[model samples]
Target chain A: MDYVLELQDVSKTYGHGRTAVKANDRVNLQIQPGEIVLIMGPSGSGKTTLLSMAGLLLSTSSGIICVLGEQIDHASASHRAHMRLKTLGFVFQSYNLMESLTAIENVELVMNMAGVRGSRAKERARELLAMLGLGERLDHKPADLSGGEKQRVAIARALANDPPLILADEPTGNLDSKTGQEVMELLCCGLGRDQGRSIVIVTHDHRLRSIADRVLWLEDGQLSETDGNYLPEMT
Target chain B: MFKLAWRNLLHERARLIISVGGVALAVMLILLMAGIFAGSEEHAVAYIKRQPADLWLMQDGVENLHMSSSLLPPQVVEDVRGIAGVYQAVGLLYSTGAVDLGETEVYSYIFAVEKGAPFGGPWDLMEGAGSPGIDEVILDSDLAARYGLGLGDTVDLLGKQLRIAGLSEGTFGIATSITFVNKQTLAGLMGVPPDAASYVLIRPESDADRVQVADRLKEAIPEANLMTREAFVASDQEMIRQMGADVIRAMNSVAYVVGLLVIALTVYTATVERAREYGVLKAIGADTALLMRVVAAQAFISSGFGFLVGIPLAYGIGALITTLLPEMLIVIEPDNLLGQVPVLLAITAAASLLPLGRIIRLDPMTVFKG
Candidate 1:
């Protein structure tokens, strides 16, 4: 399968000498269209580190990252952010919804910042919220919504630009088991339902493992594929 | 994108409210001080405007009537009248005295124009009267309100008892209300033995050159000082300007400092509070200039709200002050108030720049770390 996002020999090191920790060492990954890939690891197993590098949120100490066959490792800061905003959608662990904005407004915020103005952008935001089953919560602010609703709103925001690649770091980490499962299912099917896009969710929740098409286990900065059902059942 | 800036301002409603209040307070202080300065200016020129003559003839070498002139002989009025284009001339004594209203004594200025001279008085009347005769006096509205005097009341002026005739409005000097009386009444009140008046006022023909009339009067009576109407008004205005300009300037500077500090702290707090949101915005392709504009837009929102509330509050407060104060204590000129809008905007923009710097430094990767 042709990879929609590819990372080659990616490495990120923090500090130096004895105190230095290698967050990711020569990490390599590939994500293809219409696929949902899950990266599961403990807190320090470099799952988020690798995800950040793939998402272009952080600069790698060394190596190349290619998105849609375009090398972004050497891209300018503004160019990289533009690529992220236009071609990549991110779902943060905390949901990262602007608490002040209503659900629909949060979605519209991304569209508006991307130069979408007036009533059309607003209508598009409403459509996305309805697609996420948040039609009734459109005008509800983040503070007034439930955990599941907020996560769905975050998913709607990530889908704002209809980007080809979605990068999520523990997207359901803050939800309870039921909401987490619903969020995982929503996220897994959120973009992959479209033929031209893919999702890469970095999470430790075993429940999410069943929803992802393939699971990649990261232990001590190394990735290896595991049977999707081998993880211990979530409580 | 800039529309997002406006939405963000509304989103962060608390910050908007607080910042608007700060700007309004600063605006109020600045406007009030401006009103006082304007009032002082009007007061300084009041008597000059009512001088009854187009030409002022004082002792030679006089630069200001209030400070520099010696008493010119009453005969100087005849000499000035003899000058070509001089229409009418009247000699008058201008001095300061104390008036006794029962247990309270008030200091007042005495302007003694000849009875039935071309010069008249204020815009309105508030107390006992107009065109006072010998042993008669007029009290300013504020003075009447202050001492509880009425039209039929008798007051002691510089020791002589004079019956109150009519009250005038909008003609109060800095600390005193002026009394207008005929030359004989004022001279008698001052114990000048009703002799030659202190200075002469000359009215030139309507189309005549006032400066030329002034020069001819100077030549005709070398012992008297001659000044055009404009010079006379300017000289009087300069005294108040000199007395109060520095203080007003310093107050204005303090107001600006307070405004700057308030806006800076408020915007800076807003920026720091939303550091993560800024990260999200940057991650979403918001450029540096876009972020700067967003910050500036927030400042504009705050200032715009301030403009709406501050101007009317300024007028309301100014009105209250105008009511409580003598007319000369506050002048709320619309033009002066309107002129301050741009200056306030400049302060708000400049103060918000520092917070914009903080916002521009936000990195999209910062939020991912959390």
Candidate 2:
């Protein structure tokens, strides 16, 4: 019953009055430890907004967000940053690796921010890169790496601090079908199952459903759990 | 943070070179101007500084040697010597005359001193005799080399042939070349009384209080102005600085502005190009201070490299100018180079402000979107 992340009646709106746009409307969700949760929706369905709120990257108009059993909906920016450093990790669709840094450096950047440095941080970063199958490319910058390799480096970076939860927004969105499947397998089987860490992935790629312990459908800013048999029609 | 900043700078090699080169050029310009200014001041007062006098007594209302005409009564020298603290007093005769080189005339300031006097004559002798005798002259080596004159060569000064007795080093000013002759000979040529002189040089006793001696001299001789060695040097340098203060100030301002723009534009562009990366960093929990540190590190590295490159380049340029124009004095002092460090650092820090603002206001949500 211990959840890694929880959201209660979260709603986020932009602007005000008649011109206000609701990005997320009254969304509630929770992910237990060691669970793999998948959120699938059409374009403009507020899937990204919901993920942003859960990651403590954006303030919610009205809601309660808890990460690692600490209420953080009203946390200060600095406090939220600290919690993110201590408990949460992020994987972006674009990989978002610092182009100036090598693979090992990108992975070590987070650890450095968390006060880990020198030989220990370097050793851990190398190990993570090698584990992610990027050992030979450790010194190569992002420009020299392929899309799949970049995403792998991003995943290694997200896991650098060993946070309890990983919030991935379309981790495989930029890769080919085969590479996407491979990355998905790595995230689910390699990370979620083998490492016993909770993962929340927001993606439009329904092919990823087989790896999910629970599938949720988001439509017009609302989320609902469903059995694996249901498939939303592709627009 | 420093590693990140260094990597970011090295990531774009072309930008790094251009930015560093720009700063280097600015530094070179500022240093060159300062060196030339300092050189000019030094040259203007070289003769005054070389004198062994601790005090200079001139006619009242005469401010400096170069711009003023001081004709003191020759009796002032004996009067100053009679003082209790007076160690030695020598009279000098200063005038301007032209040396006819057959094809062209070289204008020079003529300094006439008593033969074998303690001061007011050339100290650095490259060749021949140390002090000029009657009808003999000492010319600056730079002037001698330029006109192909040597020791024992005779030159026409004020229509009188005077043999060159010695060649002194580094005694040439931009507008005036100093030539020394016997005081009695110069007085006869100018038709002034041999007992009258331009100024009197005085050396105080070793144990004497210079201020008290100066006060006593002021009281004993109310018609003349008396100044200590340090006071006279400062007055001469201050006069020279004021002459070019407007131009030097304008050039320094331009150099600083150019340096600021170069650094600001390069850093701002680099930051803008990496804005998304910065957002990603913010999203991953980099605080504002850390990000600022990264920027400050970049500025410092750039400035440090620029300074390292600029100093030698300035000196090289100064050497080149001296070779090309022997009359131009470009003296590089250690203090001049050291004085520019703070200004360069300030410009670099100010330049980083442009990029700092861009990074601080960056929204972390942008990384999630695009």
Candidate 3:
């Protein structure tokens, strides 16, 4: 139970026989609680495929995936969703807050899905958004918020249910440099790590390595640790 | 979330209005068509439904008064009155023909009641006497007004000229206008003895058991069919509905189809518009049941609001019709409203299926694309 997420030799392949392409070839990774693991990879390196498998958003062709001591590789879709709601949270790159919902409501949605509703959920969502500097923008929809504000709302939503693990896919890809750095700092250093939550970030941003506890690189559907010798790339 | 579905509908205010409006109009159409049929049936059986008859005695095998010929001898009325528990019995002669109003001939049902009978038919008058005198007839006030005819004005009934002795109320419609005349005139016209009668209506004594009295009357007059008031009213309504209920049913089916299309199209388009949001929800721990709930909630919101709005609109239109066309009545009974609730719910449920399937099959991974 020390590791919040564990993936053992996970493999995913699209199609079969004559026209098979392996997206992840027996990838193995483990993320411990309160750890910031940054996944940097080239496009089509199957980084997203690996992240999706870890997040329980996609099924692995062959592997043992466990989240919070529960083996969910073969769980029913509903069960996996339940696991995701209770044990994991996600932050998308585009800040995919529902257009119809306000900033506070976007954050409250995950908690509501976990059956934490009414005023308790509302107060938690409010505290999360306020911590992320979205107190004044609580009533603003996705359309009204700036990119950085939207990403903060996404982070607030990701932490709304107080899940132990957070999976962020290019959380700052839509923001400018200063704004992106602030969002990353607020997500990984401010609220996430301080609250004993593990964070997994999949991105092409090399500058994000400074805050990460471990920076790993994905290439050709395989994972490898990037030492100081790794070259920096433009996001 | 249901709140999410509701907000999604509310976000597009114009589409929401159009969607709910479409459903409301369809519901109104169906209810109005049904109300019209019910109103017509009520009008056709006005005499039977309005009268306080405990039992009806007609010629053997004549089950209804509308479009039925029942020739009971006048002695049957006296025989029914003589039965224990029988308070009073009145006889009537019925015929169907057009009334010659000099300028225009209006199709009507002509009934001949006894001149001094207190318990005969819907003998209520709006402006004139309650019963017709010798060589006199009682016509609907609306019909008399339409032709510039009034009390003491003459109308030709079966080629016999008779004065309009009284003008009756609620006896006119698009069809089935009633004209009441004295039994002596009708008997003389049909070349039958004045004592002959077509049907007999009986009122049971206040403290008597109607079933026992009806049995005794039936035994005494085997040549006549005996029916309680409820059976008689139902039979008349059945005959009246046969004339137009099929058209009403067909119209109602079309309206329901319109409602289905409106709800389905709006929900389908709304789902497609929010496909990415739905994908986000799916990726973030929303199960198929939750997605289905959102879709179903949207459909029910549209249909439930539409139905709630339709009832008042139907009543408003009914009032407008009553004012503009006094002879036409629109009867939207509580039973009618209660009956349509299941139909609307079923339509809403059916409307949700397409969008539900669309979202259930959506891959949450698609939200990762951009």
Candidate 4:
């Protein structure tokens, strides 16, 4: 199978000697194109660390991380940034949008960073926001939007660059249950099934398991696949 | 990037106004100080510059017309006129005297000009005759309006009654009000011999080289100090600058420091406030240079608006000074205003440094957290 992301025995350690903390230990994972993978774990169980390593945001102490067929473990910072821009998208829990910019502008900012400019960038931004059911709220700033609308804007921003792999870290954590389900439905059904983009979500919500093609459980710096019966209260 | 910078500034309107207002006030202060200095220098040399003489001859020890007194033998004027390049030579007598205006005694500098000569007389005759007869005086219009004196009005100078024969424009220096009279009258009033004068004014022939004529005249009258009109004007301005350059420099230093601090604090606070947004940008693939451009754009925009507000404010202040202090001259030239452009740009550039460091070191990982 064609893999969008593959982590081969990746381990990350913080600090030195006796004080060293192992965040990720020999983690091996793979997500195929058009697949949705959910990673669940208790707090401080290296769920975010695994996502960070897979996204090329954090370096691994040992082993290799490949995204979109490129081994990024030994890449320079600038080269990693280029790979991130060209091959990956990110959705955070807080809906990180520039407060000064409107919804469409926030979406367009990512495109701008990718060297797209003028009316073409604006058109793409409008198309993305409208596709996410935010057509009427295009001109509204983040402060003026509800939690659901803000998450939608963040999703629109992540999809601005059209990267193959979407790394979402608790994207629906801050929303109400209804809004969180709606956001997950938009991601799994709209982006995965329709656009054929691979998704890796590090979430604590048990309800999200129904939409995942496979569920991965993380415990004490180790990752393992499990059936939905092993769910825990990770809050 | 530019739009982001502009929107970020506008997001905090109150802070934006304060930052721009601070820079505007600084610019206004610096311009005002420079304008006042230039005006004073121009005023000090007004009378000398208006004269038609190419060369001025004084006693060998005298360098300026304000504080020093020079007495030349009357034969020197005739001897200078005998030179090949000399067109006309006239003797002038300068003395300080007080004019009694009934309730006030106004100090005046008496300029005694030879009758019918072009060298040492008022050229801008606003009203009445250019040449004042014996026991007559030509007053600057500014001086006349101040004292309510007009043509045909008589005033007491040196205990002698003299009639106001003419009024000239722009003859009032910063510290001196000049009054022109016949040479014989002033010589008689001071009890000096009619054959003696304070300085000799010489006009070179239209076809003659002024430097060569001045050199030849310098050789002829070795006992006198000879200078061209430009040299004398420069010397007078230099003397006046020496009196106030220190004060102007101090004021300029204060203004620049204040400007720098205002810009630094505002831009730094703004950058720190937006640190999270900058981190998100970095996480999303923005380079440090791109981030710095945004901060620099903020500084430049603030300075541009400040300059827009400052230039008009400086002109308004100059107008107010002119209205409140009629005797004071505040000249705002275009060059003086344009000269501040580079200074403002430098200040804005320097101000961006404090914020640029914060942006460069900001951790992009912070954007992942709530």
Candidate 5:
């Protein structure tokens, strides 16, 4: 398999000297196209740290991180940021939509920064919003939308650049089970399911286990895959 | 984009309206106060500009005719005319007297000039016959209408019966309405006797520099004060500079400080409301330069609205002042206007900087933490 995201012996240390603590200890992982890898770990098991390093939000202390064939661990801040914006899309636990903008404007905000402009950019945003079931709520402000509607708007914003890799950090952590399921289904139902796009989800929710094709267990700064048919040992 | 900036401004129309209104009101008041100060200076120096004298010889230590007393020998005019480059000199007697026309008692200034000099009297006759003949006088239109007096009308001036010879406009000075008469008539009216005049006004034969002439004349008569026409006008303005300047500065300071405060508050509130929005923008790949541009665009929008409202409002205030205070024309000098717009722009630009610094440093990750 041609892996889209690969990490080799990655190590991350939180502090210096006596207070030093290792988050991700020489961990190795690979995610290929059309793969949904769910990262499961107990509290303080370095799952978020690993995801952060993978998403280019945090730097690893040692080892190589390659995303879209670019070595990000040794890259410049702007270079890594560029990679994050072009090749990666983020859906955070909190649906961070700009309250001042309408639903379509929040999505268009991403496209605007991506240097997409004029009528074509606007039409693309409209189509994206319509695809996310937000066509009628384009003019409605965030305060006027429900929890699920806001999350859908955030999802639309994340997909604005048509990036090939999606990194979701507890995307449904704040939602009810039904709404979480709905958002996850919306994310997985289309191109994410059939097309060759990679998805890495950081979650501890057992309910989301059935949707992911593979589940990676992270504990004591190590990772191993578990079968989807059996319950994995916690921590 | 500029369209986004414009829409953001319009979206908060009420708040933006209040902000622009504050700036416009400040601009109007600043222009009006400056006009009043200019008007006062012009009123104080009106006669000095009109006088055709190359030099004025008055009593030693006298600064201006309005603010100082000048005593000189009446024979000084003849002595100054004998100096080289001196063509003709006139002995002028400046004094104040009341003219009583039965129902109205009008205070009038009397300027006594030698009979043959060019600076003999006022100009632009309106309704009367001509220059004051022997024992006659000139009355301005306002004074004439108020006193119901016209040509050949007998007026009691300083206990002597005088006749109205002509009507004119702008014949009033800082003291009161001016009446032109010969030296003999004025000397008799003021009871100064024959030996003394107020000052000697001299005209150079050629267009010689008045400062050189004044110096030479001062050397000839050490007991007298020498002044050029420009110096005389400047001295006259000192009284207005003393009177209206403090008031103008105070008014401008109040308007400027209040305008700055309003701009600061407006920008601060707007930035506070958009803090989360700024974070979202950063997360979406907008850089610091792009964020600053959006903020500057918003300021431009606010200032443009203020300019649209302020410039016209300043003119209207000037017109209203001129109409209500007819004797005064609110003069907005070029320097005063040039200084004000930039001050407003500076306040606006500075106001934006404070909030921009706050917005630029905000991290997008913090928004996710929320």
Candidate 6:
């Protein structure tokens, strides 16, 4: 089966020469359609770096990076942006919604950027926000929304264009335990369905493991598979 | 996308006001400078414009009335009238000098209009008659009001104390004041023949092509210069414009710079403040072009609002200036106001460039850092 995302011998190095630090050293990973992959690691373990590379937000020093079965390691900046908009979505740790825009507008903005406009974009935004249980808070700005609500809005935005892959980095870092569980369940769906959407979440929270189809362990710039219940020592 | 840019601008009321107000001040400065130049242009040509003559005749080689010297022989007026297209012609004695009103002396263009002759006199009068007696002067009523003088008040001209018997309207300007005296009175003081005019005002016959009439008069009086009214007014206006061209250009430059800086600084600051949000947008897959377009749209809206608000403010100040200082005319011409649109647009684009670069180089990866 064609994987939704693939990484082969991808490496990212900061600086050069003697001072160079390898963030992701020859990392390889693959994710299939409708798969939910959770990447858990200690501080500075290169989880964000791996996620950044997969999301096309950062360039890899060497190796192949593919999204939706298309090689994109050498894509132009403009082309990279187009791929991100059309084939991938991102949920940042900070909830990263445009604070100036209302919840519905925040969702509509991504659609508008993707050639969706006017009433069509508006209707899609309303449906997404309503699906995220933010139907009554469409006009609320980011500042006015609660932590869970903001994350929900960010999720709605991530799902706005219904891209095949979603890359989230610590999406529940700022949320309470119960709300974070509820939000992650809504993400993988409490209804137990992904609708053919793949999600790659990087987080330190172990509670998210229940909602993920596969929980992957990332340590020292390398990714490894693990049994669902295992937790590494904090060191 | 445009809505996002607008929302960002409207997010903070205080910042919005400062941004819009800064642009408004710049627009006001640009418009006021242009209005003054246009206003003074009219004032400079007021003398010729107010006359009803279709053509002007003067001494050979003399071009305009202001800063010019012309003395046509007395027979030149008759010679110009003898041409077929010339319906009527009147001789005028003109001089540029100071008119002493007791403790105040006003620089003035003193014209001697022949009694009861058509044209070459005050076109509008506030009081008294268009024709002045030997010992009487027709002066601007606004000038008279400014100095606590009225009709029958005494003003000293050419060392002779004369009464202000006629009050003309629209004769006072920043350049000089125009006052009319009897042709015989000024001729004696000027030591010239009463018939030897500084310039001759000519009227073309009904149904006559003014260009042909001017050509015929020029041919008939080869020793004197003959010009159609349009050319004569343009010539004088050009001379006056050249006089202040350097100063006006410098002022316009300063105003434009101020406007440019105002827009640039505010837009730059706003963009910088919102850089994080911009990075977020980029991270979420917004293209560089769409983001840059947002920045540009915000800048245009800011400057557009300023343009709309500044015009009315300029007009109000112009009216106030006219009421307070009657000698200075501040004319707000539509052409002058509309001309700044392109320059303001250029300024808006230039101002957005700094922010555009910031957006262009912004790393979308930064948004991923917890």
| Winner by lDDT | 2
State the TM-score, rounded to 2 decimals, of chain A in model 1.
Answer: 0.94
Interface RMSD of each: 2.0, 0.9, 0.9, 1.2, 2.8, 1.0
State the lDDT of candidate 6 residue by residue for B13-40, as single tens digits: 6877887887888788877777777777
- Put down candidate 2 lDDT per residue, A1-235, tens digits, no spaces: 6578999999999899999989888999999988999998888888999998998889999989988788999988889888888788899999999999999999999999999999999999999888888989999999999999999999999999998899999988899999999887986788666788999999888888899999998888888888857868645
Predict model 1's lDDT versus the native. Answer: 0.77
lDDT of 4 by residue, A75-133 (tens): 98778777777788889999889999999999988888889988988999999888889
- How far residue B188's Cα lies from its native spot in candidate 1, in Å, is 7.9
Task: State the TM-score for model 5.
Answer: 0.69
- Model 4: DockQ score: 0.56
Lowest summed-lDDT stretch of 10 residues in model 5 chain B?
B172-181
> What TM-score does each of the candidates earn?
0.87, 0.87, 0.90, 0.85, 0.69, 0.94
Give lDDT tens digits, candidate 3, residues B1-370: 8889888889988888888998999888888888888888888788887777878889898998878787877677777778899898888788888889998888888888787887664556788777777899899998898889999889998899999888988998766698888889888887777778888878889999988998899788887898988998988887777877788889999999999999999989988888888888888899988988988898899888888888899889888987788778788888988988999899899999978778878888876776
Model 4 clash tally, residue pairs: 0
Error of 4 at B369 (Å): 2.2
List all candidate RMSDs to the true structure.
Answer: 3.7, 3.8, 3.0, 4.1, 7.0, 2.2
Q: How accurate locally is residue A120 in candidate 1, as Cα lDDT from 0 to 100?
A: 82
Best by DockQ: 6
Candidate with maximal TM-score: 6
DockQ of structure 2: 0.68
List the DockQ of the predictions in order.
0.46, 0.68, 0.67, 0.56, 0.25, 0.76
Q: Cα lDDT of all candidates, in order?
A: 0.77, 0.87, 0.86, 0.86, 0.76, 0.86
- Residue-wise C-alpha lDDT for candidate 5, range B105-169, written one tens digit per residue: 76776776755556746766687654465677777766776667778888888888888877777
Residue A230 of candidate 6: its Cα lDDT? 72
Model 3 TM-score? 0.90
Question: Which is the winner by lDDT between candidate 4 and candidate 5?
Answer: 4
